[model samples]
Every structure is written in C-alpha cells, then in structure tokens.
Target: MTKQTGGKRWGRKATGESAQVRDGRPRRSRRNTFREDEDLEEQINFSDIKRIGVYLKPYLKQGAVILAAVLSMSAIAVAIPYLTKTMIDTVIPSKDPVKLFTLGGVFLVAIVVYELLLRYRTVAITRVGQLMLKDMRRDLFTHIQTLPFSYFDSRPHGKILIRVVNYVNTLSDTLSSGLINVIADIFTFLLTLIVMFLIDWRLTLWSLVLMPLLVVYVLFLQHFQRRAYQRLSNKQSNLNAYIHESIAGVKTTQTFVREREQFQTFQEQQGQVRKYWMKAVHIQYLMWPGVQNISTITIALIYYLGITGMGGVQVTTGMLIAFVGYANNFWNPIINIGNFYNQLITCSAYLERIFETLDVRPEIEDKPGAVELPPIKGRVDFNDVVFKYEPDGRNILNLVDFHVPAGSTVALVGPTGAGKTTIVNLLSRFYDVSEGSVCVDGYDVRDVTLSSLRRQMGVMLQDTFIFTGNVRENIRYGRLDATDEEIVEAAKAVHAHEFIMELPQGYDTKVEERGSTLSAGQRQLIAFSRVLLADPRILILDEATSSIDTRTEEALQAGLAHLLKGRTSFVIAHRLSTIEHSDQIFYIDHGQIIEHGTHEELLAKKGAYYRLHESQYAMIKTANGEEG
Candidate 1:
C-alpha cells in the first residue's frame, strides 16, 4: 500500500470514520456536548432532593442524633445572647455582686456546654456524610460497569472520570457540612428575629425594613453565580480530558516533536479554566459586599431608633445593647444562608451530571426471565443479522449470514471496515443484533444472562492489555481460582515461561500499566497465557498474533493449534499460516462473505482472497530483501 492509502485505512478503522455517513449525508453523533445556551438556569427539584434524602435513610437513627445536636447548638446560641441581656439589665444595674458572680458562672458553664455540643455535632455530621459518600461512589462505579459500550464510546474518558471523581467529591460538602449548616442558619435566623421583636418591636421593625431588598439583591447575584459556576465546571472537564489524552499519547507527541504545540494547547485550556473561576469569584464578591452593606445599614437604623426612643417606647441602654446583639445574629444567618445558596446552585449542575450517569439504562441487559447458559457447545449461527452502532447511522453489518459448526476453526479475511469484528461482537452478545438472532449452542445469546454467556467465552484482541500486576496475577485474571502451578503451566505452554522466569522477580515480577515495560511480542505472549488459563469452549482471536515476532509466532502456533482443538474459534486472518490451517476460510467484504473454502480451494478460485494473499506475500518478500 502507498503511505496515503495506509494512513487513510488505519484512520478510518481506528475512528469509525468510514461509517460516519449514510445515504450521502453525514451521520449525526449521539454524543452529548456541553453548550452555554443549554439550560444555564438552576432550578431546585424536590425529587432530586428526595432522592438524596434516601441516601441518609440508612443512617436515619444517627441523623436524628445529629439533628438534635444541631438544634441544641442553636438553642444554646440563643440562650447566650439572652444571658448577656440579663447580666447587663438585672445583674449589673443594681450593683448586686453576688448575682453578678452567679450569672457569670452560669454563662461560663453555658459556653463549655455549647462547645461540647458543637464538637459532637461536627463529628457526627461529618461521619454520616462520609458514609453516604462511600455508598454513592460505590453505586456510581457499579452502575458505570452496567452501561453499554456505546455509552462509553459516545463520551470522552476524561468527562466520565470527572463525574466519578471531582463531581462526586463536590457532594461531600453538601452531604456533611452544607446540610447541617443550612438548617442551623435557618433556625438561628428565626430565633434571633423572635427575640428582637420581644426586646422592642419598634427597633425590630427598623432592623428588618431593608431585609427584602437584601433578599432581592441576593437572588440577582445567584443567577450570575450559577452561570459562572456552570462555565467553570465545563472548563474543568475539558481540562481533564485534554490532560488525560496528552498523557496517554505523549509518545506520539514526542515522536512528532509537538511538545511546544501541546504545551501551548495546555496553556490555552488552563487559561479558559482560570477565566471561568475568576468570573465566579467576581460574582461572589458582588454578593458578599452587598449583603454586608445592607446588614450594616440595618444595624445603623436600629441604633438611630434606640437613641431617639422611637414609637413612644423607652429604649433602655441594656435593651438597646441586647437588641443590637439580636440584630447581628439575625443578619449573620441570612448571610450564611445566602452563601450556601450559591454553593447549592453550583453543586446543582454537578448533582445533575452524577444523576445523569446513574439514570442510563444499559442498552443490552439480561431479559427479565433470562436463563443462565450452561456450558456452551460452541455451535454459532447468525441468521440475517443487521447491526448499527447508532440507530440512525450506517449499518455496520447488513443482512450478514454465516454459521460456524461446533469445534471448528474459522478464519475471517477482510479488508478494513468489512465487519470482521462485528461478527465476534455479536456472538459474544456485547451488543444485541438490530434484526434477527445470533445463536450459540442453539440458544439466542441475548436470551441468556450476560455474565453466564461471557464467562464461558474468551477473546484475545489485536491490542493485548496487561493490567498492572505480576505476570502470575495477570494470567490468574482469566480464572481467579487457578492455582499458581496452573498459572505457570499455562505460561509455559504459550512459551512465555522462559522470559518470565528471567524477569527481575520471576512470576512475581511487577507489570507496568498496560504492560508498557514489555515489548509487543512479550505482551502478546502474556495474553496467550491468560487465554489458555481460561480454557473456554469458544475463543475468538482478532489479529492476536499480529504483534508477535516471526520466531515467537512459530512457537505460539504449535501451542495455539493444540488449544484450538475441539473449540469453536474465530480468527481474523492476516497471516498466511493462520489462514492455511483453518477448518474453513471466509473472505468477507462489505458485510458479505464473498468466498468460503479451504486454502487450496480459495487459491484455485483465484478470487479476492487470492489477490490479498499475493499482495501480502510480495510485501513480506520485499521487506526481507530490504533487511538483507
């Protein structure tokens, strides 16, 4: 292939670019995108609040204790202000030293008790919130696993990660500190207002006159606050996505010497994040100053009324002082609540994001009465199967029909985008067929529990993934109950034992993430061992040996031939060796099998498979001559 043709083929295959159109029009993506015009308003929903409340239900008994503690703290706060009023009016005015001392002692005792209650409430509330957070994280992760592959394919990995991490962490404050603080502030505000009215109704009215104006201003600030926070959340998610992509593809970036370009891109994303954060800060600054100014004006008005003895009421010094105290208490809670209102507004979007993930129903789930499939006999059949990743997108597999007899090895040969992988995906039931049925052992794969069906099938893909663990542990992942001896035996069978034993720690040698420390050939060998340990009745290898060295390929073919015996296996044919030995060969193109026969039979026909074999052989010979 020419360089341009090869690049185009790889690009279209990797990104599903070839399937991006239907009927000569571009296919619309199903992915959701964040847009500024999309519902920037934050409206409180009772159902969402109620759903969060359910998380607290399991800790209801403990929540009550926390509630009681919070209530007591508020009550004690109210009592302290009254005690000061009494000490100033009754205890001090008459010069009664004994009463003064006694009141002073009582005040000291109240302070100590208040501190104790505050400590209890803080610890109890925090602990409960933490427990609730734990449960929410667990549920979110478990729910993510149940979602269909298409759900993940539609969104960036970083966006999903942000929901699982930053967004969930944001809930911790609301669950623990935010909930209790809001309740406490509300109660304090009401109690202080009552006491103010009792002290002198005239001054009380003066202090509250500007209250509605403050509320209106706060609401105005909150609108901007919510919008600013929404922007910040969007930018933060974008930044996370960029960072994850950059790290994963750093090798490519370095090879192309695009570090400077990537760094500039990083700076641009960071700049966006900073801009949104500053906008939120500016909005908050406007709100807090406005609230404080209104509060100060109210205090000034109360003092003016007290000094003048307004409304024909005598305002004693003690009463005036006590009223001022109540006035401060009254405004303090409003300010606190106003701040918290902004917090809730910001968190509202994050909450919605989290709930959106939880609300997704898996596209392919077990039927209500789906039975657990017994051991599969490996007979696979596809009858007029049609499939599309998106409902409105081009059909990936159109009216495809094929059958693999029990205990047979089938090699699928196709150019890129010929629906080779889609066949295996259907047989495994990763997705349900859009039309007709995929049957394994005479049972529709969709009619069986997903776990029961998948557990009995093993897939070794072109890109082998070795998780972060020891060699032994990675192999044991196929069958968690496998003994160490069995693991080593499987490794030896795949010719992986010699290299593994030479590693720094032998079987216990640490594997880096994605097995980056290992070569391509070594990773494929480890993958082979993983599959062998599973010993499934049906095995699918999609270009599994594509990365192995010529020498290693020779060693693996012996073990693979033995392993393929009496098991239904589908291999996406690339190598001549793999195709030649198959019980049957299928030459597929454009979602149709153009030819099917043994190696000798296909050569005699001199059709599509013949051309493909000739080209591949010529390329190999040219490569060998160049090496020489």
Candidate 2:
C-alpha cells in the first residue's frame, strides 16, 4: 500500500473498458477479489481534515458547549477515584457519622452533575453532527449534479448511492461520538497519571513498564486492521452495486426466470462481505486481549512490589488502593484510544472515496470567460467534427461537416451504431467534439454556459424516464413554474389528456417509480408533453413515436408537426411515415453521410438512401397492400 501524499486529484477522463455484453447486461466475473488496489494510499492529509473543520466551524457555539461538558465529565470521573480514596482513608476511618453522610451526599451530587453534563454533551454533539451531515450530503449531491455524464457513465448507481447514504452515515458515527470519546479518554488518562504520580511516583512508574510493548502491539495490529477494512469497504461497494443493478432490472430477471441465478450471485456477494468483516473483527478482537493481559500484568507488578514498600519507602493502604484505581484508568484509556484509532482507519477509506469523487472536474465544462448563450436562432453547424468516446479509440464520427438552417426539419437515418445518436449528442454538447467544433447560432458550444445552451434545447429519447410523482407533477418537471392550465394544455397537445382523464385520479394519479404504473405508450406521451411544455427552440425526437399505437401516433404526429413547424428539429426513426415528411434526410454509414437530400430527390438519385428505404419499408408496404 502506498503512503498518502498531500496532493492527488481525480483525473477527468473516465478510465474503464466496457464491462457489458451486446445485450446491455453487465458481464459477471467469477474472480473473488474485490477492487484490491495494492497501491491504495493511507492517511488523509491535514488539508482534508481542515476541509472537515470548515463543516464544524458553523457549529462552533455547540462545540464550545460540548467541550465544556467533556471537561466537566472528565473532571468528575477523576474525582470519583479520589473521592473513593478519601472515603476509605478519612470519612470511614474517622468514625464520625456526620462526616460520612456529608461525603456520601457530595458523591451523590457529583454523580448527578456528571450525568447531566453527559446528557447535554450527547444532545448537543449529536445535533451538531446531524447538521454537518446535512451540509456535507447536500454539497456532495449538488457537486454530483454539476459533473458531466461521463462520471455517471463509468461509475455504478449503487456505488454512488452508498457514498451519499451509507458512507456518510459511517462518518457520522465517528464525528458525532467517536471523536469526543477519544478526547475524553485522553483527558482521563492524563488526569489519572498525574494523580497516580502524586500518590506514589515509584509505583506509578512500575505499573507503566509494559506501556511501550502495548503501544508496539497496537501499532502493528493497526496496519492489518486498515487492510481488512479497505477490503470490507470494497466488498460492500461491490455488493451494493450488484443489488442496485438487480433491483433496477428486476423485471428482466423475472421475465427471463433468472431469479435463482441472481440470488446465488447475491449470496456470493454477501458471503464476501461477511468474510472481510470477520477479518477486520479478528484484528480488532486482538486488541481487547492484548490490552487485558498487559493491564493484568501491570496491576500484579504494582501490587507485589508496593507490598514490599519500594526501596524502604513506606506505602499506606489507602494510597496503594488509590494508585491501583488510577492504574486501571490509565491502562483502560489506552484500550479506548486503540479502538478509536481503529475506527479512524476504517473511516479514512470512506473519506478518501468521497473526496476522490468531489475532486473530478467535469470533462465538458465551459471554458474560462464562457458566456450565457443568447436566445439562439437554432442554426447549428458541424465543422469537421470528429469524436470518439475514448481518447485513443476509433472515431465514432469522422470529419463530419453539416449545416442545418434555422427552423428546418432534418431526419437522421442509419443502421444501429452508424453515429446517428452521436451527432445529436454533440449538437447538444453532451460531449465535446475531439478534433473540431459544434457551433450553435455561430457561437461555439464550448464557449457558452451549459445551462443556457441546454435549457433552450429539448430532447426526447427512446427510453423515456418518468420520475415518481403525480401526473401533473411529472408534466410540470419540464418547466418547474408551469401552471396547471399550461400542463393540461401540453398533455392535450400530445393527445395524452384523454387517457390521463380516464385514470381513477385523472391528473392527480400517482405514478410509480420509473413510471412502472404507466403503459409504454402512456409514458412516451407524458415525455412528449413534458418537452412540449418546455417549448425549446431546438427539438430532438429519437424514436419518439415508436411506442404509440397507429391511431394515437397519427394524433401525436399532428401535434408534433404543429410544435415542430417553426423550430429546428432532428428526428431519428425507423418507420417510413415518421420521416416521410422531413424537409431533408441524411443517410449515414460508417460515421459519414453517404447520401443527403429530400425524399423524392433521394429516390431520383437511386443510390444508398433509395435502396435502404426500399429494403427496409417496402416489405411492410407490400404486406399492407399499399403503393410502394
């Protein structure tokens, strides 16, 4: 393992090969090893700790209270040992009833005060910790939003979720109580040491003879403890990623009767988590016995040597008794400190992962001095555009040059993987071109703020995602401030109003997550309605009408044509009718436009486009007995 350096950052280029099959399923690996980064670094630097300190800065007043409580609690704990000595040597031996009662009352009052301070400390620190967590999680989620698509593309949903939820919660455990306990233990240890020395310095020195050995043993165990926790953390992330994938694709699993297989995979992941946890536990458990044995030996030495009055220096019974109490306090605090150190080691791994994500700069961020895109006229130009998903990979689009006049309809027709979607992705600036520029209204896309550029463009993809919400709420997602009337009008435009009204709760009907409660066609219509409500100047419809029935599609096409009349639109479709009315068509092949013209003009050319149209849709036309 590498020692952590002060400076290391998450590189922008998402680095990973596709671990998926042609069917879009992740390839399963039989290898039992988790992400065992042998060169994984240890030690979060002071700068990262200071970043955390910034979170605590806002709760300084609460921290002051907690500090006061901790000091009070520690003082009371030390006082109890001294009070026991006083009672045994003074009040009880004096044979005065009044004095004994006074000492007992004082002890009871001290206990009450200690309890109150402990309670206050718990409440205040817990409140402060919760507030810090809220701030941290918010910052993380907000930062995630600003990240480019490639980050999400390379990482698993479950892994991200774990960082936001479980890992943050783990940090909360350390911040809220673990840290305070460490501080209290330190104070208790020091106070006990001072009092023990004042009582009998010789005995105190003798009792701590085994201290260096204990320290050495704990320090050795720490390295193993850290390695075990790293493995455990990696296993948990893997398990969560698998579970998330499984749950997200449960319908596919059930339909294909792969539940048993998936269950077996889950069991394997679970067993790995348990095995790693046990290894960590094995290391942690060693501390308890090691500390116990050393502590026992220390006390035995103190008692045996003190009975002989160390070098003719006499020792009183009360003083010896007090020394023993202080000895227990001294050794036990070491054990507590060891436990705290172990927790810090475990938490450090999680902290590193979280910060690594935060350090990744967005690959497609606007350049310095980028401006807000003006109201665009929607004239897009691709000037010798070249792109590849990977840095050194084959170009997906090679020297592509095109100009789309404002407010024109262009149909993209191609085979799968023929760069149909890649063109649109570049146009939207979802990714930057590798070797050339994509310009919107003469302004290079990279020179404009992403929000201003994307806000004016609407894309409806083949796979429509519907967030869990009521029908009205889902429609309003496109324009957050859109009125209910405007939402209804948008739905009506897409011919979704009729079906939506027929539902039990109409517009108020609650949709399940991913719109599972809605039919495919219904979800597509809702997605169309959302885009319509947004009323973007540039519209992209990729297989938009594929899911609707013939009659419903006809109705939707009318609304779509009305919506598309004055906007620059790009359409990708397989159906002949969907592109039949397009103003121009670009027939692409092998990342180049082989043919481009209107439908009739392309037919007259009798080239690639003509053959493609005839072979692809001619059979369907013949089956319907329609003129080809």
Clashing pairs in 2: none
Give the range of the ten consecutive residues with the poorest summed lDDT in model 1: 1-10
Q: What's the lDDT for candidate 2?
A: 0.81
Candidate achieving the largest lDDT:
2
lDDT of 1 by residue, 1-628 (tens): 0010111111112121122332343323235432111123245433445578878889989988888788777888887778888988888988998999999999898889889988998888899999988888888999989876667776667777988899889888788877777888899999888887887777778787998898789777777777787778788887887887889899999999999999998898889889989998888788778889999998888788888877765787778777778888888888888877777877776775676567666667899999999987899888777777655556677666778899999899989999899889888887777776789999999889999998989899998999998888999999999999999989988889989999999989999999999999899889989988999999999999899888888887876778789999998967876669898888877766778888988989999999989998999999999999
Residue 50 of model 2 has an lDDT of: 48
Where model 2 places Cα greater than 4 Å from the true spot, the runs are 1-51, 96-98, 311-313, 625-628
Query: How many clashing pairs per prediction, in order?
Result: 0, 0
Task: Judge candidate 1 at residue 626 and give its lDDT.
Answer: 100
User: Which stretches of model 1 miss by more than 4 angstroms?
Assistant: 1-50
List model 2 lDDT by residue over 1-628, tens digit each.
Answer: 0111121121123222323231333332122222322124454333445477778888888787798789788888888878888888888899999999998999999999998988898888888888988998998898888776666666677777888888888888778876667888899999888988888777778887898998899888878887787778788888888888899999999999999999999998889999999998898788889988999999888788778876554576777777777788888788888877777877777776676556655667778999999998899888877777766667677777889999999999988899998899888887788767889899999899999999999999999999998999999999999999999999999999999999999999999999999999999999999998998999999888889988998888887778888899999987767788998898877788778889999989999888888897767768678643
- Which window of ten consecutive residues has the lowest lDDT sum in model 2? 1-10
Query: In candidate 1, how many Å is residue 450 off?
Result: 0.4
